[model samples]
Target chain A: MHVLVLGSGQLARMMSLAGAPLNITMSAYDVTTDRVVHPLTQAVIDQTLDQAIAAADVITAEFEHIPHDILAICDKSGKFLPSTDAIKAGGDRRLEKALLDNSGVKNATYYVINNRADFDAAIQHVGIPMVLKSALGGYDGKGQWRLKDSTQVDTIWQEMQECLNGSAQQAIVAEQFVAFDREVSLVGARSASGEVAVYPLAENIHVNGVLSLSTAIDAPELQEQAKQMFTAVANSLDYVGVLAIEFFDVNGELLVNEIAPRVHNSGHWTQQGAEVCQFENHVRAVCGLPLGSTKLVRETAMINILGEDTLPTELLAMEGCHIHWYGKGKRPGRKMGHINVTADYSGELQRKLCEIAGYLDAKAFPAVHEVAQKIRS
Target chain B: MHVLVLGSGQLARMMSLAGAPLNITMSAYDVTTDRVVHPLTQAVIDQTLDQAIAAADVITAEFEHIPHDILAICDKSGKFLPSTDAIKAGGDRRLEKALLDNSGVKNATYYVINNRADFDAAIQHVGIPMVLKSALGGYDGKGQWRLKDSTQVDTIWQEMQECLNGSAQQAIVAEQFVAFDREVSLVGARSASGEVAVYPLAENIHVNGVLSLSTAIDAPELQEQAKQMFTAVANSLDYVGVLAIEFFDVNGELLVNEIAPRVHNSGHWTQQGAEVCQFENHVRAVCGLPLGSTKLVRETAMINILGEDTLPTELLAMEGCHIHWYGKGKRPGRKMGHINVTADYSGELQRKLCEIAGYLDAKAFPAVHEVAQKIRS
Candidate 1:
């Protein structure tokens, strides 16, 4: 089977690797290029866009932000997975909130706004300490406004008016903030056959609302609840392929926070922890194959290597730490790669996390040479 | 780094995959094609043999049976891993035994022979109930003859003579048979800098001496012993890539059975169980990157899917079971694929194993339908 991926990136590259042995050929288009290459090759396959699309048996995306024109072509082919509707729901906060309400998936209260009057009314309804998100193309805390005080209301209203252009209308959401203990995400896949396989709930740690680390465990109650929520959402959208649902754990309440309608960064540990990786499962689901397992092999912690941090050779020298470099040119706050450290012992897992974090942060471990130097002093 | 591979097979394919992300390119030359393609691609990258070698930074084989001409080219490059010297020891039983004896690694006593008379004398010297093996190009119970009684020796001698052809003498090993409890293998990777990482010892089961299943677990004592032996052999050969040592558990003694200079089939579980797979480690070692963690994630059992059996969908439907199908046209006794199953609970692991094995073997479980049929009967 031939699969065409809408975006060409690491996820598409990984999907190509996973699909190769199954005799499922993957060709991905970099919307920027007319030349289509096998994801792993980064070499030219088809010189024309139409030929590449004609060659594909199925069409899917590595992420939700696929260009509307490309998605329209796929929709016309009647072979696109997770559907354009599902993707739009995931991409726009307003659509996502509406879908959640209609699907009966519990979520934080939200109000959509188009102009200053609507924004003012939303502020009145939701009050201060609310999250105002652009309805489109917002991620990792980008294009977001947080109202922390009433003094900022006038500035926010002006900003909203400017954002709306001359029509005094622009789509956005003002959501009531839920004070949560922790953030978790359920990365799950559903096939066209309505078969759903949910990976273990990943406890995510975010630095400035960007995912930094995700750890997986057998938290039975949490897993079961997350599984139910994921399944219900997948079924409601008639979703085919992988979906990641981020949840705000307010005490025991799992308030729906967001959704990623593609294989997510949070599920990266499944590459080593499970028999089948989330990327592979997404390919299988999108290609209409039976879903593979979503079981965790060990407690695994995945740390994002943001920017050009000097690698800690000492960390690689340690047991149970696996490093993956993306080979991308690095910039500040850019995702260069990640390291997955897995172990049976939670204490060891914690130590590994601290060690990697220290290395990436360039914070020297004080327990060894420093201790000796201090003793001599 | 540029890596030249001797054999163009799946192991080579995987090595290429591991190398790609690191910007370490691999070129594999199939004896038939002679055209070097990017290993991940079986597409031609270099049409001339000399050009391929000239482009290589390191040369290696995916298997031991590399044709002599290719070995000579790699040998002249002075960059061949597990060196051509070490590979020679692994490819032939006589050389393997000689190396084992010189290195003081434990092994069954053996003597080389060229003819039936030599074999008979060696058997008389070593005693009956012995094993005979051809010196080269044998794997998984091939090119082997087992002698249980003297009465059948003459007929076996005739078959051996035909197998040997007329060099007037072909090499073979005559040794006492090991009465073993179970078989196991240790896979270790060493870098040019003398840094080495050993994956946990894997318990293996072979059906008719062809590996059927393998389970890798963290047994500290066994791991230390295996590490000691592997490190000794690796250091002795100045090996700079993956080395797999197969062992026989003779009553409590770990007698070395054979050695593979390339990634061995037994280490397939490492794909799911280890922090870094043996293939990735081989790539890292050859590419001059720091070696990855060899820690086992959990107790994992990998089952080879042999022959032309159609895999059942139910097996894939199970949690924690991942199937990897080789894109090969199937035949009886051909390796179609393998399944790696892991679990948090031993009971669940065993149950999954049985459920998957039953599906593959076409044995139905005792379900409500079966119970109802039994009641009717």
Candidate 2:
């Protein structure tokens, strides 16, 4: 089967790798270059988006931040999976929040702001200590603000107004902040036949607003809560593919923080630790194949290799530690690659994480250092 | 790092898949067409073999049946790994026999045949009820004959003479046949720095001399004996990549049968059963990277998908079952792909294998059906 992914990035490359074993060949439409290319080789194909869409047996996206015109064209081909509406909801915060509300999934309370009057009303409606996110384009802590007090509102709004001015479709979403105990995510796949399989919940750690570590946890209660929300959201969207829903675990109750309508970073551990990896599952789901078993095969943790391109040579020799590089040129804080650490049991996984921490730079791998310290303590 | 592989078949394709995760990119030299191509896609590259060899940081072979001229050119590039001599030894049965004798490994007693006189001499030397195999270019039960009695000698010799006429270097090798208890293989890697790591022994089953099934076993005595022979063979070759040694287990004693100079079919179970599969280990060893741990993570069995394309869809939902397709056009008894069955324990793996048999056609998957019946009866 031939699959054409909409984004030529690490996710698409990984999907290509995962799909090949199942006899699923993949090509990607580079959103940046506007060219069709082999995701693994990054070799540009002499084919247009129209040609690729026509050629593909199935069409999907590695990300949600694609241009709408292209999405519309792909959607019109009747080959796109998980629906373009799901992609739009993931990209636009207002739509996501509304979808969550309609689906009856617990999410942060928010009000969309297009002008100063709406911002003032949003402050009144959502209250202080609010998290402000740009509706259309903000990601990775960019185009965001924290309105901690009334004194800072004017100053924050000035930046927010600038962000709002970039595109007419853009707006600020002022959300009522919910202090959370920890962050976790549920990555699951829903087949075209409406069958769903959710992997074990992964506890995620963020460093400076970017994801740094994700460890698959055996929290039965949290997993139940997350899966319920996941199923509700997926069924609501009529989704068909891998979907990742980030949760803010406040006390014991889980609240949806965000949704990624594609294969996600938190689920990368599946490559080494799960029955069927998320990348392969995503391909299987989108291609109208039966969803594979999402059972946890091992106790595993994934450490995001942010910014750094190389790891300690000794780490390669370490049992259960597998490195996956993105084959991209390096830049500061980029998602260069990730190391998946697996163990027969949970305690062994923690020990391996600590050992991994020893070989990693504390500055470069702050999340792992924090996790190792926490484990030690 | 870039690797240029000889033979753009499934082995090279799998190597490309395994290498991509570690940021190792690959292009393959298709010996048949004399074209450089991507191993996975088989897309003809615009570059010549000379250019690919020049561009590669390391050059390796997926199969040993490469043309001598191509091998010479690759060897001259100063990048080819495991040495062309090891490849030659793997291709030629006479050199392989000599190599085993030099390596001090226990192997079958054999004599080489050139003409009718040599055949008569081999009959006198090795006696009747012997196995005759071509010296070069024979695999998968091809170019072979059996001398069950004195009466069948003339007919078998006629076919042998025809085989010898194909090439000047070609001859027949007559071996005293051993009635083995079982056939097993050991796949291991020797690094550029001489670091050796081997997985547990896998007991293999062959149908019509083509491998049909391989299961990772837990016999400690056999593992120890196999490892000793494996280390001896690898050390004698001074090998710098993954090498597979086939053995005839004669009442718990292993006699070297044949050696594959690259990753072997018997090791495909390692993809899901062991840490760092043979394909990746071969890549790491040839690229001069650290060898990954060869620890067994799961009890696994591999069922070869001979001459088939699609499998039962219900198998996809089976936990511990993973299908890997080679993306090849099918022919009668062709090695089209394989299925990997994994479980937490041997009992579970056996049960899963039996379950897989129920879903597979008996004639199409005869070995699996045989094993399943044996387990049940």
Candidate 3:
């Protein structure tokens, strides 16, 4: 079976790696170029858009920002998985909140807004210490504004108005603040046969609102809860591929932060930690194949190598940590690669994490500080 | 750092996958086309053999049967790993036994034979219950003869002579049979830095003299001793990549059977069971990168898919079993693919194994067998 992905990036490259061994061809729809290339360059898929869509047995997106025209072509071909409606819901916070509410899923309290008056009214009702998020095109903390106090509300509103860029009104949503202790994600897949397999919950950490690291652990209770959540959401939407739900741990209560309607960044640890990677499972579900095992092998931590200013070559020589650099040019705050560190013992995970963080930024640790202090001493 | 592999097959394909994420370029020398293609079609390598050898940071092989000329070129470049001597020792059984004797390694008592008379003499010396094997180009029970009794020796010798087919004198070896309970393999890697890590010993089972399944387990004391023996061999030879040492478990003693200079089929389970697969770890060691974690997540069983005709699609539907097809044109006895089944519980592994074996041949297992039939009214 052949699978077509909407974005031509490293995620697509990895999906190709996972699919090629199954004899399933993975071709990408380069949204930017409007041309198709085998995700890993095994085959050139540069046919007309319609022809390419027709050639595939199933179509999915690597990211939510896929061009609407391409999605329309896929919709006409009837090859899109997770459905366009699901993607739209995932893309727009208002739509997602409404879907969650209707499905009886738990999420942060929020309300939709259209204009300044609406925003003011939301603050009156939801109060300060709330988050304002654009209905679409928001990720990595962009397009989201945190209102601290009434004294700063006017300046924040003015800045938000500047962000709208001359549009008299733009769609946005307000969410009540939740003081969560930790963040985690559940990556799961559902086959057309309705067989759903959920990978272990992955604890995630972010730096500057961008994912910095993720670790997969065996938490029986978390796994049970995550599996039920995934099943509920997948069954409700008739989802037929992989999806990831981000959850905030608020004093042991799980609050749904958002859902990614495709393979997610937090799941990258599965490439080395699980029996079957999320990429392969996604392809399996979409291609009408059997869902694979999602069992974790050991404690695994994946560190995103963001804004690559060249990683220390010395760190690449460290045992137990495998470097994975996306074949992408470096850009600040952009994901260029990641390092996966696996260990048999849980304590080793933290050691590896510290070692990796130290390698990335020497000054971030006391050993590095001591070295600097020694130079000064 | 860049690494070049000498074969463009599944081993090379896997090596490429492992290398790509590190941004380390790996090109495979395609003997059929006399051109180098990126192991995964990710890069175009040098077309000329000389240029490939020159451009390569280190040279290694996916199989021991690499062309001697190319091996010599790489040897001349002073960049070849595992060494041509080691590969030659692995490729031919006579040389292999000789090396074992010289290294003082424990192995089956054997003697080389050049004629029917020599074969008879060796059988007499080694005893009646002996096995005769061709010195070269033999694997999975091919080019082998069994001598059961003295009366049948002449006929067996004559038949073996006929099988040899008039080549002046065909080289062969005869060995006294040793009672073995099971087979085990030690897969380990030695880095350029002289650091070595051996994966947990894998217990293996063979059907029709071909490896049918393997599982990683904690080795007994005797097995640990055998692993130390392998470590000595690896260090003595200055081997810098993954090596497989097959052993025969006789009574409670472990004796060496054979050695593979490159990654062996038995190690395929590591693709899903370990933090870093054998192929990638081999590439990393050869490229002077640090070794990856070799911790096994759970017990894993790998079943080789032999011959296209026996390819079982039903096995793909089984839970926790991931099927990998090599995309090679299937032929009788050809290794087209494999399935890796893993689980936190050993029962899951056995269940998947039975399901897979059942898919291959239903008649092999009795659907319903009554041990006793009572003559009841």
Candidate 4:
């Protein structure tokens, strides 16, 4: 089967790699250029967009930010998986919050602000020390503002207003600050035939709002709750393909943070840790094939190699380390690649994390060092 | 670095997949078309052959049967790994036998027959009930003859004489048939810097001379012997890249059968069973990167899917099964793809193998059924 992916990025590249061994061909459209690129190598294909679209048997997205017009074209084809509505909900915080509330899933209490009156109401309802984020076009802490006290609220509000001055949609979401014990994410897939499979909860650490590291956690209670949340959201949306839901673990209680309607960075560990990776599972789900096993086979820790033009060659020599360079030119704060290390025990996994951290700049990767130190102590 | 491969087949395809995550670009030459194909996707490139060759930082071969003229071009570049000499030795049974004898490795007693006089000597030395094999252009039981009794010797000799009548090199080897307990292969790699790492020995079973299944064996003594054999051969050859040596286990004693200079079918289980796969290790050896760990993470069994146009979709749902389709046309005796199943225990692995065998034709896949039945019993 030929699968057309909406974005040509690392996730799409990896999905193509996983699909190749299953006789599943992938054609990716560059969202920025609207041109076709080979999914596995990211080389510009010598074909037009129409030709690529015509060849695809199914359509999916690597990310939710695909333009609405392109999504409309795929929707007309009746081959798109997970529905455009699901992508919209994943991209827009307001729609996602509504879905969470409707599903009775616990999330940080929040309010939407489209004007001064709404902002005032949000402040009154969500209280101080809240996070003000644009309902759309926000990721990795971009398009976001943090309110520490009343003194800075007006300044942040003016900044948001200025940013939204000429936008068609002038709205933001204010969420109550959640003081959580740890951050975690659950990645799962739902087939077009209504079959669902969820991987284990992965404890995550984000630095400067970009994912730094993620390790699979074996908390049965939290894992069960996470599975329930995934099922409720996926079944309600009638989702097809992989879905990743991030959560904040607050003293054992889980709260929804956000959801990604595609294969996610947090689930990259599954490539080396689980019987079936998230990319393969996503392909199987969209292609109307049965989902593979999601069983975790090892204790895995994934470390993002952000913005580094070169990694130490010694890292490859480290036991259990697997490097995944994206073959993209390095840019500051961009995810250039990642390394996954698997171990038989949590202690060994921590030691490996520390070893990897040594090869990286500690100041630039404070989250990695923090986790390493936490585990060391 | 960009890597140019000599052959564009599934082995090259998998090598490219393994190299991509290491920031390595693989460009493969289709020996038939003499054109460049993207290794992972098999899409023909629009660039010129010289341009592709100029862009490559190193040259390698996916298989040992590369034409000598192309080997000369790559040799002139001085960037080819596992030098042309090693590949030549691997392709020619005579040279390989000489190397085995020089290394003091125990192989089945054999004699070369180049003419009628030599054939008479071979018959006298090797006796009846021997195997006659062409010194060149042979694989998977082709170009071979088995002598069960003296009555068939002259007939087979006349057939070989007819086929080799016009050939420049008219030669074959006759060997005393070995009665073996099982077939096994040891896959290992030697870096340019002389670093070597060996994976666990894989117990292999072949049907009609095509490998059908291989399981990682934990026999310490036999594994040690295999490692020693690999090390002696690799060190003597000054090899850099993965090497596979097939052996016969006769009454607990190991006897060398053949050697492959590149990754072998017997090592496909490493994809999901080891910390690093044979493909990645080969890439590392040729790229001057440090070798990753060869630690086996799970007990694995690999099954080849040969010549079939369709596979049951339900097989994907089987726990621990990983499919690898080559995207090749279905032809009798062609390797279309393979499936790998990994489990935590030997009993569980066998059960999974039986489960896979159920999806295949019992008659065509008697080897699979036999093993499944043996495991069940």
Candidate 5:
């Protein structure tokens, strides 16, 4: 079967790699150039976008923010997995919040702020110590503001106003900041047949709102809650592919932080730790194939290598280290690659994580250091 | 660093896939067309052969039978791993035998038959119930004659004469047939820095001389013997890439059958079973990168899908089944692809093997049936 992916990034490249062995040909639509290239396909690249789309049995996106026009075209084909509504819900904070509320899933208390009156109402309802975020086009800590006190509220409001002007639909959501003990995420796949397979909850560490490290947590209660949240959201959205729900573990209570309606970076460790990686499971779900086993074969820790192109040779030489260098040009703050380290036990995994953290720049990889500190304590 | 592979087949494709995450670019030289294409590279296919060769930091072959002229050119560059001499030894039966003998490796008792006198001498020494094989251009049960009785010697001699006419050296090897309990092979990699890592020996089964199934065997004594044989041969050849040595396990004694100087089919299970696959290790060795761990992460069984294109979806739906479909046209007796099934324990692996064997045609996959029977008994 032929699958057309919307983005031509490393995720798409990996999806193609996983699909090739299953006899599933993948072609990526480069949104910038309007050109299509089969990342790991055996067929030579000669087909146009329209030709590829016409030939594809299924269409999916590598990232959540697919252009509306392109998504509309795929939607009309009736072969798009996860549906356009699901992508829209993931793209817009307001829509995602509404879906979570409708599904009876517990999320951080929030209020929508579109204008001065709405902002005043949000401040009155949500109170201080809240995060103000644009409803659309916000990721990796961008388009966000933290309100520490009334003194800082004006400056945060002025900065958020710029986001309102730039956004097509000028709106933002203010969420009450929860003093969470740890951050966690659950990544799972739901098939068209309503079959769901959820991976264990991953304890995540984010530096500057960008995920730095994620290790599969063995907390049974948290895992059960994550599964429930995933099911509620997936069923509500009629999801038919991999979905990730980031949660804040507040004194053992799981509060939804965000949802990614695609394969997530937090689940990268699955490539080495689980029987089937998230990328392959996502492909299988979208292609209408049976979902693979999500059984964890080993304890794994993933460290994201952001912006750095040159890596130390010793990093590759490290035992249990699996480097995944995205073949993209190096740019500051860009996700160039990641390292996955697997071990037989959690202690060994933690030690390996500390060793790898020592190899990376402390400023660039603050999350790794945080995780290492937590493990040491 | 860039690696130029002198064959654009599935082996090269898999090698490219494994090399991508290591930040290594691989360009494949299609000897048939004299064109080069980087299999997993982000770079587009637009460079000429000379340009690719000039740009490559190292050169290697996916298969042993590399053309003499191309091998010579690569040899002149002094960047080719596993020198042309090793490839020559692997290509010709006589040269391989001499190397094995000189290295003091125990191989099948054989006599070189070049002329009528040698053929007569062979019949006297090797006796009846022997196998006569051409020294060149033989693979997958081709260019072979079985002398089950003395009465069939004259007809076999005339048929063998045609192979002599086609061969450059005009030679054949006649070996005394031994009843073997089972077939096994050892696949290992040796780096330029004299670092060697060997995977556990795999018990193999061939149907019509085409490999059908291979499972990683845990017999310590046989595994030790296989590793010693591999080290002896690799050190003698000064090899610097993945090498495979096929062995015949009679009772408990191991007899060398043949050696392949590249990644062999028997090692395909490593993709899912080992910490690092053979292809990845080969790329590491060739690129001067540190070799990865060869630790067996799980028990695995690899079944070759020969001459079939239409596979049942149920085979994929089966738990632990990993399909590797080579994008090649199917022809009778041709290796179309392979299926690798991994399990946590040997009993689970045996059950999975039986389940998969039931799905395959009994006649076309007799080896699978045989294994299933053995496991059942």
Candidate 6:
């Protein structure tokens, strides 16, 4: 089966790797280049979007931030999986908030702000200590502000207005920021036949708004809550393929922060920790193949290799530590690659994490260093 | 890092897949077409052999049957790994026998035959119950004869004479065939610093001289013996990549049957069962990187998917069962793909093997069926 992913990036490249063994060929549509290419090789194929869609047995997106016109074309092909609405909602916080409300999932109360008056109204509705996020095209802390007090509203609004004015469809989403104990994510796949399989909840740590560390955790209470919310969101959308929902763990109760309508970085640990990796599961779901088991087989953590193209060669000598480079040229703070560290038993993963930290730059990999320090203490 | 593989078959394809994660890009030299190609896509790359060799950081072969002229060219480049002599010995039975003897490893007593006179002399020297195999290009039970008794000598010699007269390089190596209880193979890697890392011995089962099944076994005595032979052979060749030595297990004593200069079929179980897979380890050795651990992480068995392209969808739903297709067209008796079945603990793998046998054809997967039957009864 040939699957045409609607974005040419690391996610598509990983999907290609996972799909190859199952005889599922993966190609990516470079939205910028307007060309179809082999994701892994990045070699351009002489085919238009329509031609690619026609050739594909299934179509899916690697990221939710795809152009609506392109998404519509793929959706019209009747080969796209996980529904076009899910993709749009994932990209737009306004739609995402409505989706959470409609699905009856626990999430932060929010109001959309389009202008100065709307911003004033949002402050009244959502109150102080709110988080302002651009409703469209905002990710990894970009186009965001934290309103801790009334004093910072003017400065925050000036930035928010610039983002809103830049894109006519953009608006500000003011959410009531909950003081959460920790952040966690649930990555699960829903099959065409409504079979849902969720991996263990990954306790996440973000450094400067980008995910830095994600470890598969065994908190039964958090997992049960996350799985329920995952099922609700997935069922409401009638989702096909993998979906990741980031949640704020507020004193053990989960609140949906956002959703990704594709395989996620937090689930990368599944490549070594679980029965089947999320990339393969996503392809299996979209292609109408049965979902492989998502059972966790090992204690594992994944550390994002941001910006740096090179890592300590000693990392290769460490057993159960697998480095995966994305084959992308290095740029400051770019998602260059990741390392998945697996352990045989409980607590061993923590020790491995500490050992891994000794080799990484503390500033570049703050989350790993923090975990190491915390564990050592 | 860029790697140029010698052959554009499934082995090269898998090696490319394995190498990609390490930011190692792989291109293949298609010996038959004399063109460079992407091993996975089989897309022709517009580069001459000399250009590819110059561009490559490392050059290796997926198989040992490469033409000597190409080997000479690559060897001259000072980047081709594991030495050229190891590959030549693997391809020629006469050289392979000498290698085993020179390495001081136990093997079958053999005599080389060039004509009818030599065949008569070989019979007198080696005695009855012998196996006759072509010195060059013999594999998968082809170009072979069994001289079990004096009654079959005349017909066997007639067939041998035609093969000898066909090419000046052709010769039959007559060996004293000792009845062995089972077959096992040791796949290991020798790095540039002469660091050797060997995986657990894989108990292999062959159907019609074609490998059908391999399972990682925990026979300490056999493992120690196999490792000794593996180290001897690899050290003798100064090998710098994965080398597989096949053995005849006669009451736990191992006799080196043959050696493959590249990764072997028996090591396929490592993909799902071991800490670091053989393909990745082979690439690491050739690229001058530290070798990863060769620890068995799961109880697993690999079943060759010979001559079949499609499998039942329910097989995908089976826990711990992973299917790997070579993305090749179906051909009669071709090694199209394989299924790696992993289990959490001891005895679970045998039960899963039986379950897998239920979904496979008895004739197509006779080795799996035999193991299942043996385990059950």
Alpha-carbon runs more than 4 Å astray in model 4: B47-49
**DockQ of all candidate complexes:** 0.42, 0.90, 0.43, 0.89, 0.69, 0.95
Q: Is candidate 2 or candidate 6 better by DockQ?
A: 6
Q: Which CAPRI category fits model 1?
A: acceptable
Cα miss at A287, model 5 (Å)? Answer: 0.9
Local distance difference test scores for all models: 0.78, 0.93, 0.77, 0.88, 0.87, 0.94
Name the runs in model 3 displaced over 4 angstroms: A41-48, A109-117, A166-170, A217-232, A293-297, A309-322, A343-348, A351-377, B38-46, B114-129, B149-170, B308-319, B345-377
Per-residue lDDT over A1-377 for candidate 2, one digit per residue giving the tens place of the 0 to 100 score: 99999999999999999999899999999988889999999988999999999899999999999899999999999999889999999999999999999999999889999999999999899999899999987777888899999999899989988998899999989999889999999999999888999999999999878899999989999999899999999999999999999999999999999999999999999999899999999999998788889999889999999899999898998989999999989999999999999998889998999999999999999999998999999
Residue B207 displacement in candidate 1 (angstroms): 3.5
Q: Which parts of model 6 have CA positions greater than 4 angstroms off?
A: none
Model 2: colliding residue pairs: none
B1-377 in candidate 6: lDDT tens per residue? 89999999999999989999999999999998999999999999999999999999999998888899999999999999888999999999999999999999999999999988898899989999999999999998899899999999999988999888888998999999889999999999999999999999999998899999999999999999999999999999888999999999999899999899999899999999999999999999999999999999999889999999999887899999999999999999999999999998768988888888998889899998999999999
> Candidate 3, A120: how far from true, in Å?
3.7
- lDDT tens per residue, model 3, A134-165: 87778888888888888878887787777666
For residue A207, what is the lDDT in candidate 1?
71
Clashing pairs in 4: A21-B325
Which residue pairs in model 1 clash with each other? none
Q: What ranking emerges by lDDT with the best candidate at the front?
A: 6, 2, 4, 5, 1, 3
- What lDDT score is found at residue B93 in candidate 4? 86
Candidate 4 CA-lDDT value = 0.88
Model 1, span A186-220: residue lDDT tens: 99999998989888888887777677778886678
Q: Which ten residues in a row have the lowest lDDT in candidate 4 chain B?
A: B162-171
> Candidates 4 and 5: which is better by DockQ?
4
Cα lDDT tens digits, model 6, A219-253, are 99989989999999999999999999999999889
Task: Give a tens-digit lDDT track for model 1, residues B1-377.
Answer: 67888887778887876776555667887877677777665767745777887888888888887677778877887777868978888887888888888778898877777877898788878778889888887788988899899997888888778778844435778888889887889998999899989998988877766887787765677677778888888888888899999988776578899999989889888876677788889988877778888877656778887775467777767766767666667787777777787776655666666666556552222221232343345
Show pairs that collide, candidate 6: none
> Candidate 5 on A214-323: residue-level lDDT in tens?
88879998899889989999999899999999999999999999999989999998989888899999999999999988889899988898998887888877778999
TM-score of chain B of each: 0.92, 0.99, 0.88, 0.97, 0.95, 0.99
RMSD to truth, every model: 5.5, 0.9, 5.1, 1.3, 2.0, 0.8
